[model samples]
Target: MRAILFVLLLLPALCFGQAAKQKDNPITIGTKQTFHSAILKENRTLWVYVPKSFTAGSKLRYPVMYLLDGEAFFTSMVGTVDYLSALGKMPEMIIVGIESTDRVRDLTPTHSPFWASGEPANDLKTSGGGPNFMAFLEKEVMPYIETRYQTETYRMLVGHSLGGLTALHALVNQPALFTSYVAIDPSVWWDNQLILKQAQKALPQKGSAGKSLFFATANTMNKGMDTVRVVQDNTQGNHNVRNSLLFRETLRKSKNLAWAWKFYPEDNHGSVPFPAQYDALRYFFNKYALDKDLNDSTITVDYIKNHYRAVSAMLQYPVLPAQGTVNSLGYISLGKKQYAKAYQFFKMNLENYPTVGNLHDSMGDYYVKIGDKKKAMEAFRKALSLEEVAETRKKLKELEAGR
Candidate 1:
């Protein structure tokens, strides 16, 4: 009888463990979606990475990063953003990686008979469809993503190789589309430096006051030749390096836009994107870091508000401290018995995220700690109204019964 009872007792725990594992197994990092494009006249598969903080009903909206060469770069970019945002080096963002059907066709701005090496570029016969591709993004992709996802006004565009060429093309021809541009080892030598020439003329005329760009090139010289030697030698193989420098100089002379460039001697074209993407993101968000000495005594609601207000001005959109940040700070204060500071942080979060049930629940906990039973009940009631979770409902019932 004791053996049977032991087995019966073990069965419930085993079943519960299995159920918990089953529930957790289906959780994913991100999701894949398909959208039919009227402009491209085909369906495109998109890889999307929503931040961990994103919830279905939350009022929070995130900036979106549209990555080119999605099949190659999507996972790396998602990992990079996820890691950095967790460190607060940058804000968590939504990543949308658009898969390509015909890369050369979609990435090249002008059709050319000769390659960057001045050889007959027969492989680019169907090139010069960049305008149409941009149209597809502007008309179809952006709208579709905005409709389906919670996105803010700030958007970033990232590309590599042929995709880098397209990113530069967009910057020159359509500067208003993205807030920042990152082009890694871009093939700017296409069509005898056609895009570079266009950039020299168009970029100045367009007035890139609020725009930011970071472009980098890898060492493409012969084994013996350095950057200076390759430029002086001007070999066909040097066309890419030479044209990229010219493009950089042209933009520098324009002097209207915020731009930065880096050359990696140790990294070649294929290996450059790994570090380049990380650096580009860091460079664009360089001002996002908070003062390191900040502590519970120094933190104030106005200081937090003002910091984000400045961030809003820089990003051209209203942004606030993440709900998680506020909640964590609130709890940290409460744990230290800093009731006033804890209440301030919690109240600020409630003001920012009025609809979030957890914020109300946290505020109730804060009130209870400060021995304010009436306010605690009010907060608990608010939480129960927003969500009928058992713990919150039980807390409310206990409070009511005690009265």
Candidate 2:
């Protein structure tokens, strides 16, 4: 009897411990994925960051940001993007961080014996593989991501240092690969300003009307030099800044590309990437703001639709307001006794998402408010067919009994 009582008492504790463990499980930020790349002829590891709103079953698709030097910047980029999106500065996106196997070999666009210092550097012997790396991204990596993930048409590329050089190369050579490019302090002096020279010739020839680019440079000049002195001195230490300025000027002359450049005097090469990334996101998504008071009588369904329509055109993708947002607007209008406005919102939801059960239920509620008993019955029946909920079934039964 004593042994049985002891065992019985311990069973509840064990069950409670299991339940607590399940409830307290840690949430993961992202996942690591690997695949064999035929172009690179090696296994490539990718760090994928999905937004908090992402769900495996949802039909929603997100824009993608491909960040170079994934191992170094994935966590920070994820945090930055999430924070900015939560504040409505930009849309939430998926981040794909591409880890580097050989930084010099994959990031350099030309095979040259000279380094950024304009001196012979034998370490560049394995360089000039940027074309191959881009091929890997276009042929292998992008296909894998598109097929495996729910992605939108808009894509952005981000890089720093040598990786920034790679991003510029992609923007110049493979302009169609991404919609926007962010190059933070790119090593434009690589091979004695080869990319700068290339950009002058390529950007105008290709026509960059629809694409966007944000490039920033740090205070890489020598201790005594300012912007003017750096350009005039043309010293080896000042080559990076000079090359970046030249590239910026070349881009400015092109009327086709929507571009922005910034010079951060307080940040060095190491410290510039973080703030540069933040500013780049802000610049790219400058048009994606919805400044409206939801409670105001002036707010209408047309206003919301027009705002998102403009955003959709900017992103070149169909962007819609969230379902919950429309639903909330409907309820707010209903509470204010604005029957026409409430009907417009509820009708817009039905048009956008015909299969959503809650939307149909809300539509039924709106019909009931307008004293349309027949339409109310139809909406409630549609909602019950989509989802067999007890409340909807009860509402349908009550309507049928009245008939």
Candidate 3:
């Protein structure tokens, strides 16, 4: 029964390796070799998604999420990451989808007869390999990713169902391994809820200020239903809902360990990953995504001008956008000795940012360049009065010298 279900569930995902050979848009699918285990000879296949902004000129490095069940989950995760990152709702980061060699053997912590009924041996069963799997990830996989890509120290670990259980195990046993955790519908029933018991015993007694964990679950079996048949019908589970809620409650009363948890009664196990992955991304970069620091006011005139020259085609230069993204096109035109273009941007910026002295001053610089000294002096004098900075003072001095 369970054995048949396991095999059936396993084949499609295993066959996904062949399908992964076909690339999806903006996502590069590939494999890597790591000597993570001797018994598992083949290393692992990893799917990677590098954002469009990850060009040669980009100076930004991104955080990472090492996801399990790559064969089934990689494509959707990549898509969500791409959409969110482009919208600036989340920081651009790499998604590393790690495929398993043999999930039944590796993803589980301890060996038992519940799932493997045919051959239950003392110590020789092809189970209890999770520790070695974790070793492969921690030692080989993580180091390889860090070395090959521009990654930051902040890392996230994400897993679904059994993978979810793996993430929780990592959290309790190796708490310092990752900065964030997104566990979707983890199997608390594994080994008679061994993980739940472990969590209860080894629970940390601290608030989650420095670290974060976002746990979620979907609607599992509804009361009197046969879970196995229901799983086959819907191809999902809701068991994690109860477990995630319980986990949240446990953490709430424990006094430490920062945590965020939600239950989606509307979502099932298979469908939960989509929304959960997106929400996890928001949670990870919530503070930085809405930051107004990078808006027009805080940027240097030179920097804006430089940016305008490069991104004007994308931003449609000189309209002086007041909201959404800052317009660097206008600023860039000013820097490139394009006096007319610079004036166009300056005037447009002035319409929205009229109180901002820099826009007027910039327009005045353009006026002086085109031999309109009166307008240039007016712009510079306004800038001087609004706020005297080194660049503005220098411009004022230049105007005085010209007179």
Candidate 4:
């Protein structure tokens, strides 16, 4: 009777485990390909998904995202890419899921034991081959894809769990490997967090100018106990977010480079990738918006004006530049001696950042030079409306006198 009761008591757990491991619904995509990597000398397969409208016209090459754990993730990622691209939330890109037939041998950096507890086992002997895998992608896989498809130079890499660890390993050890990297719930606990330590030592303290990386983690249950605490520790544990934060802060103080890091506390090991992947894609494309017009001399003030005008028309509303991009563009315009363009940017800046007294004050001077008394009065009035210090008050008084 006790034995039967024990089996009954464990029924739910058994059912849940089976459900969790069941093969996910097969995702259908627009295209798929399989090939061997000359660099790693392994047979690799990649799935490609182009949106319905993609083939209608234009030889448009797209940014590519190379994903790990292809069999399980290919369809979901294709769905994400399709939905996000259609909504204009992310740039359209080719989905390249590298299906690994030998996961254990290809994903790890070193030949090491699976557990930190020092358990003996030949059952898991096929381990540790990350460097070669990276080489396979770089030398064999990338070349094949680029040659066969409409591809842009902009590339992104993504991995989950062990794959995420492998992605991180590639980034720190091979900084030039990809333009952007997204690692979700990376097994930072792997190999005693050896890769984490390597990241600490390898992350450049300055000049992240063209490089980007996004790493995230999810909660995992430990021994049937809600492993929230352990996962939380991992999220905050190695200071992964904080380390990246400190790196960003240090870079800021030194004016080193551009990088962003974020934390996702809601997802556990299996569920975190969904959000991280979307955000990472947006982050990368926005950071590196390619110039369709490559001719430097053709990129004139008139060009910028036309672009913004088109933006306004397309949105059917005044498209104000965000304060930061506008501020940078304003200064660049002024330095380039494109007065009219500079004025447009400064005016937009004033609209977005009305409380900024300095912008108004600067606009006042520009208006005065242009002999627009009415506009100058408006600018001076806006400036004086703010908390006026002695210096600004004096400037306001001077403008009021029409001098």
How close is every model to the real structure, measured as TM-score?
A: 0.86, 0.85, 0.62, 0.57
Name the candidate, 1 or 4, with the larger lDDT value.
1
- Model 3, 209-234: lDDT tens per residue? 45677887777667654433443343
lDDT of 3: 0.68
lDDT, model 4: 0.66
For each of the candidates, the C-alpha root-mean-square deviation to the true structure, in angstroms, is 5.8, 5.3, 14.9, 18.1
List clash counts for every candidate, in order: 0, 0, 10, 4
Q: lDDT: which is higher, 2 or 3?
A: 2
**Model 3, runs deviating above 4 Å:** 1-40, 115-125, 206-209, 223-240, 291-403
Ranking by TM-score: 1, 2, 3, 4
| Pairs in steric clash, model 2 | none
Least well predicted 10-residue stretch by lDDT in candidate 2 = 113-122
Clashing pairs for model 1 are none
* Pairs of colliding residues, candidate 3: 206-256, 206-257, 207-256, 208-258, 219-238, 220-238, 305-331, 305-332, 308-328, 308-329
Write down the TM-score for model 2. Answer: 0.85
Model 1: residue 332 alpha-carbon error in angstroms = 3.5
| Model 1 ranges off by over 4 Å | 1-27, 293-296, 335-337, 388-403
- Which one wins on lDDT? 2
Top-TM-score candidate index: 1
lDDT tens digits by residue: candidate 2, 126-165: 8889889899988998888899889999999999999999
What overall lDDT, based on C-alpha atoms, would model 2 receive against the true structure?
Answer: 0.88
